[model samples]
Target: MTTFRESLARVASRRSFLAVSGLIATAMCRPALAQDAGTPSASGWAMTDGRGNTISLPTRPERVVAFSPVAAALWELGVRPVGVFGPFRQEDGSPDPQIGEVDLDAVVSIGDWEEFDLERLIALDPDLLVGLSLPDVPNTLWYVPEDASATVEAIVPTFGVTPSDRGHLGLIEDIESLAAALAADLDAPGIVATRNEFTAAEAELRDLLAEAEGLTALVISASPDEIYVANPSWFGDLRFFLAAGLPIIEPETEERWEILSWEQAAKYQADLILVDNRGGGVPFPVLDPIGTWQSLPAVQAGQVGPWHAVAPYGRRAFSNIVRELTEIIRQTDASVVA
Candidate 1:
């Protein structure tokens, strides 16, 4: 598995090349139409994606190969995908936390990060390939290598859901709608219960935030050399938090992240610090030796928590995050930064 830093570097390099070579225009040559409501037709099931590509199959797709996060979201609604790709597994051979409660033993892993096993994916005989669409990259599926995207799409109908510029709740609703189109019972007791739990969690978080006046948080991913401050507007979870009355520090950048040197780590004084907890990031403990990091107010006050920027999108997954964040806010001292 590639480290998060390494993966970001690779993506940056590829994106730069794509920009220079005018491949973005070529990628947008695919069919574009208005978004559909994933309605079922007499001939088959037809659904449009975030990229405005409607995929029609002879029947409702039964064999689905999806990105790990997408699979995890569908799993919560009782839709079991046949195969999963992307960062679904960790280097230790354990299921990645981003996958939520997926049964790894039951599904085939088609690939990891930017690499895919074309042969294994083809063998799955998937009727649909689902993944998040990169907002900055036209028609590009997240985690699907740009070089192999054509080959992969040629094998099956592809569905993309974009996560950027929307709140997490909105994204969850989109996934729920997709699950319904896949024939999952939206009124299932488990699904309904989880939705109710998520609603309650949201309320609790809002109430807690109301009391923690002036409290602010900074979201970041750390590497050995630099700190990446996430742009809240580009992240569903952070956008959701901001909309829910949490004062998340928004970096001054159009890109998804603001890169900063170690010395500039204190550029934002936040009452609480949320460090990225994904497999690709360096753990917070590993930064204890860095004097600049240690000097941060939140770090000195011990008001730091883990941030799951790319966790599986669903009621259950998000509810857990909200509840955990509520507790962290409850324990944090709002005066830490001041």
Candidate 2:
């Protein structure tokens, strides 16, 4: 029953504890051969992660284990992981929205967002572990618990890609680069087609936004008691929307999110409101009846849309999101808010 914010705070606290105890420093001392990209060196195969740590293996990794988002990105590029750890499923046993283009029945689910099964991960005999790295947390992979870090590091070479501040397009490019290194056929017909589709969708969005002036948007995630207003700079998708000329309301805070009580939900008025539609969030149906939520200008005017806040960093996934948003914007009333 732990909230997402509580889980993040726990991870940060655990990381700080590990750093002070010098476990992180000790792990870093382990020897690794350097190689640019996914090139073969005298040692074997090597690639540098987002944090600048070069991981080397005796051979190119065929059995990889990755966080769900990373696995989804690789899946779209035709690289299948042996196992995946993250929020890949909903309570009813359906695929989570964040898991894009990945066949859950085919891959091993090691764990969810809060924890991973170390024994299962070891049994997979993985040669590589891939996940995201947050800019705020150094030397730690996004979902891999800090308490299990040293053990996981000993099991396989780890690679991380930071998503924040890069924008969605930049993140997709990074994933494509990783896919190439992993021996993915970037020139494959499907891959090429998806890329083209993404480009077209981006252009369509840009064109629409060019003509649609005076429209403003607010991106948010909600719980029963509180709402988390996203800071676009920390979210790749939001940053891309902003860069594409979407007038997203910037929260008056430096942190990745501006947490507000439900009573304060109407503090920022926008023509459109994008609510996070990921699993584990309070759904629109549940919030619609709340007096404070119903009082928001966007809600009253019905200018609300779903936000895939953490879609896989793949062309196809993003293309779908962009197309959906484009349609929503096309139907939105810019005069919803004064």
Candidate 3:
């Protein structure tokens, strides 16, 4: 694993963003268009963000920067960012799978999820900084360090959609709205086709769920020490499943997740167990040796599978997940112990 300072040094050495954005800043400096047409500027663009702020750019920002999932959404809509910050790089120094086909060669990382290189971000000279924002968190930039938020915002306009804010469709809609403002061709054939595909997949899942009545699911983030069960209220994807007529087992608590002892985890039996597949969680093969995890009905029944708790939240991503879950539900044995 690369250390923070080492990552910073790596980005500083590349000096890529400064060279890439020669056209972006120049567009920002261009004169505003006529008011006779009632538009701020022919190039000006604006949209209301998840944090309830209207972020406007003097010109349709050509140089955008974001994380992997966000980059995927933008790419699907025909816009590619100039930089992408993420949790880790692969052994070959590529961004992790969470980014999903983003052009790693084109974008630079500020650092890992919890850290940022302020000077390096300034070096990007980005016209806009896009990211995820949660609901009711006064701060709008997601995953950004609190100390660095203000400074980063001051340097370039920053805004993002809250993936947890609405249903799966709602989340994509927010991204679509933002993409439209950035001049994406929302009506493009490929983009429209993806949406249609999602609709069809969702309908198929709905029919499958109807036959799998009483089937239940649990989403967990597990580690060597403890288990974190997701609270449906806190995640749009989980909520989407809950709303789709599937009975998702909810954790007892107000927080987004409930921490449990391994023994306690075995107490709540579910027909399906969705393990968090993010970098920190324990893998299925590794968990199989653990006595507590193996004792669970779902685990013993081979009902465990990877859950993308943080990645692939776009239209196609959500569609794929729904279809996957539907297949799992179809094959699930609903008589499992609780």
Candidate 4:
């Protein structure tokens, strides 16, 4: 059995952006004739959002503005938005990578995660605004500031799909239901094929982990100042692995994450470590100055990898994530890590 670090080294050499794009294109190239691609002529439609609020639309929401991850999911469902509330341009002025391969050249930038351009959003005159929400925090938009929620919702009916509350499969199903109401083909061959692939990949992951009964992993967000260990209950991604029977060690403290001072991070050990990979996340190298971090076995052995904390919850994305982790587990040496 090879150590987790050695497995990762091999995995990195095999990753290919072009190959992934090809896969996504091949798996998700939706038909232009999709009903959801056209303006909805129906008089009205209704559905419940993440907040459990019944929202009635005068017609299918063709002109939409959504959070980045939600926007990506909508694209997979064959729906495009008028604007997205994420960085429109990267630092180099390229299209934001947050939305995956979705074309955003024509999509208005409502604003980034912290603040929204209320004037720009209103000018778009969107039919709907979408994002992730939690039932516990009703009325408030998840990433959007509370000060702007009322004004934003006033312009367009807001709907949210809470992934954390719904779990992985439920989240996909909810998005499917929303897409159906919007006239997207939930049974489209492309979508059906991706779903089938995701199911098979998930099963394979479970079987692979079953063979490594003692293998364990940890999810963390590291920064120059602190380390945050994710609790499975708080993250849909971590929860997915936990449900698959993977040994994901939870933080001892009874919160969504157990925060540790940078120097204290090495005390917790696991066979593998998944560090947050979003643009804002601090890279693993940031911990180099700390002796404790250097001593951590996972880090010393290079058993760390990027975790897409806010990946789109769609069939293709889920399938890819599961497959990647399955390969890592298969390559990892249980004895070395143990």
Best by TM-score: 1
Alpha carbon deviation, residue 299, candidate 3 (Å): 1.3
Give the per-residue lDDT digits (tens) of candidate 2, residues 168-229.
66657777887888899999999999989988999999999999879999988776777778
Cα lDDT of model 4 by residue, 11-70, tens digit: 222222111111111111111212232234564666667565767767777788887766
Clashes of each: 1, 0, 0, 1
Model 3 lDDT per residue over 1-338, tens place:
33323322332222321111100011011122221221247657665666656777777677777855777778778878888765546656755655666776777877765667777788988988877664444574655777888888888888766543345566677677777777777899999999999999889988888888678888876765567776766566666777777787888886655778777867567989987665533376556667999888898898887766655447877777788888888888987854
Worst 10 residues of 4 by lDDT: 18-27
Which candidate would rank higher by TM-score, 1 or 2?
1
User: What are the runs in model 3 whose C-alpha is more than 4 Å off?
Assistant: 1-43, 92-94, 163-165, 280-282
Candidate 4 TM-score to native: 0.82
- Residue pairs with clashing backbones, model 2: none
Tens digit of per-residue lDDT, candidate 1, span 1-338: 65565544642453532221110122122233233545567787888776777778888899999888789999999999999987777788777877779999989999875568999988999989988775467778777888988998898889987543345666677778888888899999999999899989999998888888889899887777888887776566776787788999989886767889999988999999998765644386568888999999999999889887567877898899899999999999999876
Q: Mind sharing the TM-score for model 2?
A: 0.87
Clashing pairs in 1: 4-280
Q: Model 3: which residue pairs collide?
A: none
Off by over 4 Å in 1: 7-41, 280-282
